[model samples]
Target: MNQQLPLLFPNAISLTIKREDLIHPFVSGNKFRKLKYNLLQAETQQYKTLLTFGGAFSNHIAAVAYAGKEKGFKTIGIIRGDELGSKISENPTLSFAENCGMQLEFISREEYRLKSELSFIENLKAKFGDFYLIPEGGTNALAIKGCQEILTPEDAEFDYICCSIGTGGTISGIINSALPHQKVLGFPALKGDFLKEEIRSFVNKENWELLTDYHFGGYGKVNEVLIGFINSFYQKNKIPLDPIYTGKMVFGVIDLIQKNFFPAQSKILLIHTGGIQGIQGMNMKLRNKKLPIIEIND
Candidate 1:
């Protein structure tokens, strides 16, 4: 559903949000889109086990676990940070995945860096037998195929489409399907230019650009001001924005609007790629540091 935000911005610029978070209770937003075709491919190949990777608060891990269970497939999560293996009970995300019957294997950060290496995958196959593999952020050709369906014909009226970028899968799909007149803007959760290549590899269009200023502190990092913005945004819109991704993008878009980055009367659409499931985990971190936590209806 497209929800027009009531934020009072100058220049008569319009802001609307695509509520992809409502896509599913567990496999919400881009995860649902990325996993739709992947799950189908796994079944088509007659795979009974699905294996993927993620960190402690990873939305992909939780989604894959729930989606696997729902589709009657065994799920395995190769989690980063070996220390988290014993702390599963203290971690909301890991605990949720475990409750959904996902086998969790925690690895050291050093070893986790080789996640995409062929030898590392071979070792996993040797231990777990046969399984369909999904990348860390669930970005793959099939995932792009699924995400491409996020935009509808009605969305063609918007001048700019904005979304959060992780592994570049979601925005690539958007860039592929976006009209030539509409510009797609990506706000990376991480701080890096490598995403330009990652996005370019999957998309052939030049209608998109990345706004790197909104990362706040990088992936999974948020400060008090951002937390304040998220809380206030939800209070006004009654829509929960995840701190890691959607919140940052929304913050950036609004900041740009106030700075006159966009022309007058421009219509902007924000893609609310869901990450509400990570809020409990994020709140736990906030309490440890004495920072304000993100507030939502949940």
Candidate 2:
């Protein structure tokens, strides 16, 4: 469905959202896209086990776990932050993954940083005995190939395609599939322009740009302003957005509208890459900090 948000955009401009979040309850949006080809490749390779990495409340972790279970593949999640090992019961994402039969193994943050290194992967292969390894954020070539299917011929009507950036995989696909007349805009959930190089590595197109000023601190960081915007947007649009990714992108898109970033009468399509699963874990942090929690309908 193309959901228009006239209230959020300037009078002459049109803003609509592609509800990719509604694609599936668990493996929604880019997670589903990122995993589709990966899972198929694993099956083709006759790999019975799927292994990936993530943080305490990574959407990728939860998606991979459930996808593996549904596909009849044993799953393993190499989690960052060894402290999270004993606290799985307290984390909604980790707990959900565990409930889906994903084996949870926690390692130090330092070790997590070497996840892409050959030696670390070799160590994991030796320890786990040969599994299909999906990198954190699920941004491999197959993942990008899956994400490329997000935009269809119907989407050609839009002048701009906007999406939240996590590992740059989703936006890369959008950039690749976007019409030549459309400019794809990405709002990074993290604070940096480094993703430009990462995204460029995946696509041959130059029709996209990153909005770096709206991260609201960085990945996994949120404040009252962002929280309020998300809550209010949900109340108005009846569309719940996760604070980490979609919420920040929506916030930036609206702010840019107010700032006159787009030309008058521009048609914008915002890709709602799913991350709602992280809200429960994020709410836990908010409650602990005595901050306002993001409100979502049951």
Candidate 3:
């Protein structure tokens, strides 16, 4: 509901950032939008428990945990990779999820891979019984409905709407709700040729474009330039951006803007998907880089 910062370029064109990151301290950003419909569906079905998946620091897990607690439903988090409880007392996000009464189930990468199959989900359902399952990142038809609610009629018209593609749920939903005249662009954070097809299959939208070049590093990996940009962006605008999602998307948006990809007089909207808590561990890795030297001709 607060006024978000807008960046202006040449002519009267401008870029507006939807401050979804500020949606809540825990239930923040697109996570909230993505979870909105899932929660309603769970209630409608009279399901008392909600089960979902994510990594140790996953914002999706955190959001679901919080939502479950607030709405009086039991929550479970199926974590990717191995357990990290031996390493530290608590990673902040996981700790928050635990505090919200989410039962954590850490699984191997191979097991997590089978998560999408009905047989695998049925195995869990047999063990837990009668629980509603929300997919990782809450990307589904219901989630799309929730994300569509984030857009307001008063918002400026734009030819293209850009968002970071994670599981492709948010952008798919945005594409589903957007006018035919608008183009939805997704900048993938992973390195793979299959994501475009995956998104197409998920959202089934034909007016979407995927830009794959901006992921300078893979997911959760940040370089010096990204860190510098994150710091400078905060210094200039007092906005906090996580290195994983929004930071990468913003970096991509800036790159595209600099390339004159969008007309100078066109309006652009960048969805700020929230993942701030994940950045807590990025400082050391992002700061430990040696700069390359450039030769000067005298």
Candidate 4:
């Protein structure tokens, strides 16, 4: 669904949001897109188990857990923090994944970074037997393929296409399918330009750029300002945005608009790639800090 913003902008600019968040309840937005073909491929190969990696409050972990359960595959999540293993009851995301029957294995942060190494993978295969592996953030060739379908012929009229960048699969797909006249802008959740090369590896198009200014101190790090913005935005727009990705993207887009970063009369389409499951976890963190929680609809 394309929803127009209520606030009028200068230069006759119009802002619209592609509510990809509404695509599914548990496996919503980019998570749904990323997993679509991977699930089919797993079933095609008759794989009985799926193994993936994530952090404590990761949306990927939650989505993969539910996807595996619904698709009839045994799921295993290699979580980053070993300490989180003992605190599953205190963490909403981990608890949800656990509830979905995802076998959770906790590892040190250093070990987590070596997840892509051949030696580390051999260790996993030795322990878990044969299983289909989905990379962290679920980005792969098939994922990009599913994300390509996010834009349609009707979306060609937009001058700017904006979305939050994760593993770069979603934006790469959008860039590949975007109209020649449209520019795809990515707001990375991580605070780095290293994603440029990662995105370039998956796309041949030169129509996209990563906006690095709005990460709000990198992935999973949010202050009161961002929390306040997310709460207010949801209150006004009735759209629940997760703090890790969509919330930062929306905040950045609005801030850029106020700064006149876009030309007057430019039509903007923002992709609301869902990660709403993280809201409860984020709110928990906020409450621990005695800060205001995100205002989400019941």
Clashes of each: 0, 0, 1, 0
Q: Indicate the residue-level lDDT of 50 in model 3.
A: 97
lDDT of each: 0.96, 0.92, 0.78, 0.93
Candidate 2's TM-score? 0.98
For model 2, how does the per-residue alpha-carbon lDDT over 169-201 read when each residue is reduced to its tens digit?
999888888889999999999987999999989
Q: Top lDDT: which candidate number?
A: 1
lDDT for model 1 comes to: 0.96
TM-scores of all predicted structures: 0.99, 0.98, 0.89, 0.98
Alpha carbon deviation, residue 180, candidate 4 (Å): 0.3
Worst 10 residues of 3 by lDDT: 289-298
Please give the RMSD to the true structure for each candidate, in Å. 0.6, 0.9, 5.4, 0.9
Which of candidates 3 and 4 is the stronger one according to lDDT?
Answer: 4
RMSD in Å for model 1: 0.6
lDDT per residue, candidate 1, 119-216, as tens digits?
99999999999999999999999999999999999998899999999999999999999998999999999998889999999999999999999999
Model 4, backbone clash pairs (residues 3+ apart or across chains), number:
0
The most accurate candidate by TM-score is: 1
Tens-digit lDDT track of model 4 for 1-298:
8898887888788999999989988999999999999999999999999999999988999999999999999999999999998999989899999999999999999999999999999999999999999999999999999999999898989999999998899999999999999999999999889999999999998998899998999888899899899888888888888899988988988889899999989999999999998888888888999988988984
